[model samples]
Target: MELGVFLFRPLIRNRADFKQAEETLKKSEVWIRNIFKSLKEAVFVITPDRIFLDMNEAAQEMFGYTKEELVNRPSAIVHIDHEQYLEFGKKMEEVINKGEITNFQFKMRRKNGEIFPSEHTASLMVDNEGKPIGIVSVVRDLSEQKKIEEEKEKLQAQLQQAHKMEAIATLAGGIAHEFNNALTGVVGNIELLEMRLPDNKIVTEHTEAMKSSSHRMANLTSQLLAYARGGSYQAKTISLSDFVEETLPVIIPNIGPSIRIDTDLPRDIFKVNVDSAQMQMVLSAVVSNSSEALGGDGRIRVITSNEEIDAEFAKSQPGLRPGRYVCLTVEDDGEGMDEETVNKIFDPFYTTKFMGRGLGMAAAYGIIRNHGGWISVDSEQYKGTVVRIYLPAIEAEKKVKKEIITEPKLDIAEGEGTVLIIEDEEMVMNVTRAVLVRLGYHILEAKTGKEAIEIAKTFDGQIDLALLDIKLPDIQGDKVYPLIMKARPNLKVIVCSGYSIDTAQG
Candidate 1:
């Protein structure tokens, strides 16, 4: 009887323990379900037949469907492409056979027919006995991620473009330097030749041609300097409407008779502080480009308007600022450019026309940028082109008359001085010396900065002025100037360069 009682008590204890264990397991399952529901990622439980069994709140929100609409629905509802749907089925089979598959990317459709990129992971759901129940998938929206990636790529491309422009600017600077040195010799010699030649019509005509050619070369060098961001100019307050009016006589004849010219300016002209010469260059480049676009058949319109750009608008432009601007626009009804051509219009040496120098628009762009302004080009293939220039506006202030103070013209016989010429180029040095000699000044020459200092120190006579070239093989001309100054304290110094002297370089 005692043995039977002991066996019955042991059986009772085992049954009670099993019941507690079963209750704990049910609580754990409830907790796990709550955890799945709380997840930010969409969790979907799909049957082997691709029917939706259950889903979390995220899954409902992601598909734009409520729990009632999604349950028992075919998983094909979220797949926009039919082939993608078939691919999903194969992936499900893979997950079931291989235990799990992760980071499967696909396009998903919402209930509203909106589609978005998504990435998801799937694993086989099973019962305690290891029998397959359904497939559990955790899906993540990749739309924002893809957008970030695309933006990153665009920024990288812009950086590469900036680097390329920098390289081009360096090359342009070197070319301008060399070209300017050559022009100095050509122009100086031509002027000397003109002074010596007799006043015959034929002789004067040929010399004038030489002068014209030299002037054109000078203009070309100036444009290259502009492209290199080394072109120098003085900015002053100017009225845009007045400037255009004054420039019309110069511009009209060059545009040809077939192309009609029109103007639309405000009664009160927009005022901007800018370099008049550079501004003129900008206008000329735009009009010339328009004339070519028209092929001597269409109309060119010059329009001016006031504008105020906000930060939001300026954000799209890389170097633009938020402020009031005088918007000067030049539009033409000519053969316009395609997108590819328009994209490269501002690049130096890039041209669409057969006879173009390719520096017009590039110089215009650089000049505007140097003046703290922006230039935009818009064109449509076979339609037309519109070039817009935005310059900062200034408040109404006293119009100061720019005083034109000219140097007193000195006769070659009256001129008297001992001038020092420091230059590296032999032709430029010789021509410069001849000009001074003709002006009745004694010349002291040096081919380099070191040689110039040595000559200045040893010279016993009065050194009236020093014409120093900015570029030297031994040292920068600015650095050498102080040494020369120390040697000759009372001497006047004229620093010269073939290129523009920017403030930093000056």
Candidate 2:
């Protein structure tokens, strides 16, 4: 017997000892073989020529090929039987000849033509002399695992979609609530005026209130559209310094009487290529929050500087990198927040204010992100709050003065034959006519759709250009425009709408 050929954890005593060792080796081999046979995994051996030499009982049961039919057959013959690809089989042969061990995953067919995914662990077999002989492969089906992975990814995407919808729904509700309150004030004022004012005197106050409220409505709609991530705007170079200075007075008053605003913006407009409207939004939301942080009586400082934020600086901030940027810092000595509260500042509907609901800062984050910029905030309770906005910088470009549009002057026909201006709002009509009258254009006025139309048909001879408002009582201006256009075909028509142009188009 070769030394160490069979291992027995005991002392050998002559030829009898050698015979006992041989019996022990035989018993161990039977035990290992029985264990292999019990496993459901299919086991097979392939000769160097890629021909199958043996298939375990499990393999035979799985492939529906008997030992007689499979042994001595070239591995390629099983291509149809096992649904293995020819290219993969060839690759396996190449790997075997190269004496490399490998594990493979593939789909193989059964006798019934049903394909199932499988994972295989295979290595070249060798004799006791370490000479290469054939290949042994242990294969297990992986169809179940693949199914689980696909289902997990599908569920993940669905969850993401659901989260997005829920966020948008919350934002919509916030905007709607604010808008309803504003509209109620405007509508109530107009309704009160309708009861007291005489037809001629109706052109006094509520109309201007209506116009102001209409513009506010437009502004609100614009913000909601941005939060909704819809609409596109043309990008252009804008001077931040000048824009901020102009917005200072407007934002300052909104902060209330308790706050003192000090601005440190450079005189030069730090120019950037972005939509001006969106930038205004970013400025407004941040400044408003800073103001609120002060709780009505504190000082706020807006400082702008040229900064180069490098990778190291960005690492501390997260999601930022080294770049030449313009930093706009809004700092306020007010009631500040903790670190945990700040991290979630950009999540929609996350707010510290009891009355505040929509995460307006989230809108600011999205806006800055879209502008190829980043925002970071630092704060501590009662110390102060500071928000730093890092925006990429561009080389200063030559400025081209924009051509201001001058309207063509209208030649007025000399005749004050009661040029009735049919508009529902009295103040807007009165103010407009006052301006036109100052310019020598005769003005006549009606306050509603029914009254305006009645005045138009009653006035005899060239009624002149009727300055018409599209929105009115009893009927829409759009419905009135066509009737006025058709009945008074010869009358010059000028259309006016407080908010939407659609009224006149109709």
Candidate 3:
């Protein structure tokens, strides 16, 4: 009787232990299920035969399917294609054989049939005996990540381009300044020669030819200065819409008749302070670029509107500020450029045409930038192109009508005065002295600002006018002006510079 009771006791103890073990297993399974559902990454369980066994909430959301719909179904439905599925399966099998996990990027399909990039991490699940049962995979959608990476790369490229353009602009400005100084000598000498040999027809012809060539070179230098952001000579606040309307007549003849132009210049547009001639050049260049894009027979729309740039939008674009802006949009239905070509369009000397100066768009870019404006371009292959130029706007009440004044050309009448010429370049100084001396003015020359200041202080003769070069080796012309004024308070001063008057003053 004691042995039988002990056997029953052992059976009762075993039953109690089994019940406790079953409850613990149930709790663990619930905990694991809760963790799986709470996961952000899509988790999936697949049978060894590549059939979907179960999936978490994230997985169902990611693939646009419910667990009940995908369970017991082939996993190929989520893959980009059957061939990709097979390849992925082979790779998974190879990794499992090596007792490793599979991780890779693969294109995946959503329920709506949209294909997208996805990162997949998969491993084999095993039973208690260590035999493979199914696959456990965690997938991450890489679409947003790829987009962010692409945006970062684009910003980096834009920064590099801005640096390159800045360097180029410095070089161009220096060259233009030096070239203008040299041209001053040439043009002055030619004028003196013309004055001396007025009666000689042959000499007049040669001198005129030289003058024409020099004038053309001067124009080229002006364009270079424009591209260097030193070209706005006379900036005035005016109605941009009116200015465009007046300038389009002159520009239309240049663009062939096949290219139709439509303008929507609303009179209510905000006014902008810009150099009229430079703005005209910008408009002409932008129109010409669009015209060239259209081999022939395409519509071009020029529209102007008031726009307000917000801080967030301004922050995304370099060198842009938040403000009320007047936007000029030029849209063209023509052969467009690819991304690579569009990137280089604003670079100096970059062009797609067989014959082009390539400075048109570059100068346009500089002119707008110099006027406190920004330019942007959008294009697609075979689709079209759109360009937007934004200039800071002023209140309409500040708009002023600029009057046109025509000045008749006057002959160089001889003058009697004592003139002081302060110039650094030897050729420019010599030619200027000769021209003044020829005009019956006594010349006092100084190659440096110090020399000029000394001449103003100690010179016994009455100094009538002082011609001061803005740029000097010893002291800048602006600084020298105040110092020399201390000595010669009554002397009249004329400021000269290779740069525009506005830039020179600043």
The best candidate by lDDT is 3
**Residue 483 deviation, candidate 2, in Å?**
40
- Number of backbone clashes in candidate 1: 0
CA lDDT, every model vs. true structure: 0.79, 0.65, 0.81
State the TM-score for model 3.
0.88
lDDT (tens digit, per residue) of candidate 2 on 191-286: 445434647454656576676876777666545544544323445766667767877876666667978888888865356666676777788888
**What tens-digit string does per-residue lDDT give for candidate 3 at 421-449?**
88999988899899988889998988899
Candidate 1 C-alpha lDDT tens digits along 1-506 = 11112112222257778687656556666667777789999988888778888889999999899978978888898999889899999898888778765559999999999999999888786654566668879999999999989877755755565567667777887899989888888888877887777576787898889989888888888988877777667667788888887887787888779989899978686678777887888899889889888887889999988888889767555567787788899998888898778767878878687227668888888788777778887889778888889877775223211221223332335388898888998988999898888878999999899999998899998998888888888988879888998898887777777765332211
Task: lDDT for model 1, please.
Answer: 0.79
Better of 2 and 3 by lDDT: 3
Q: Could you estimate the TM-score for every candidate?
A: 0.74, 0.38, 0.88
Better by lDDT, candidate 2 or 1: 1
RMSD of 2: 17.4
Residue pairs in steric clash, candidate 2? 82-109, 203-426, 421-444, 470-477
Q: Tell how far residue 341 is off in model 1, in angstroms.
A: 4.9
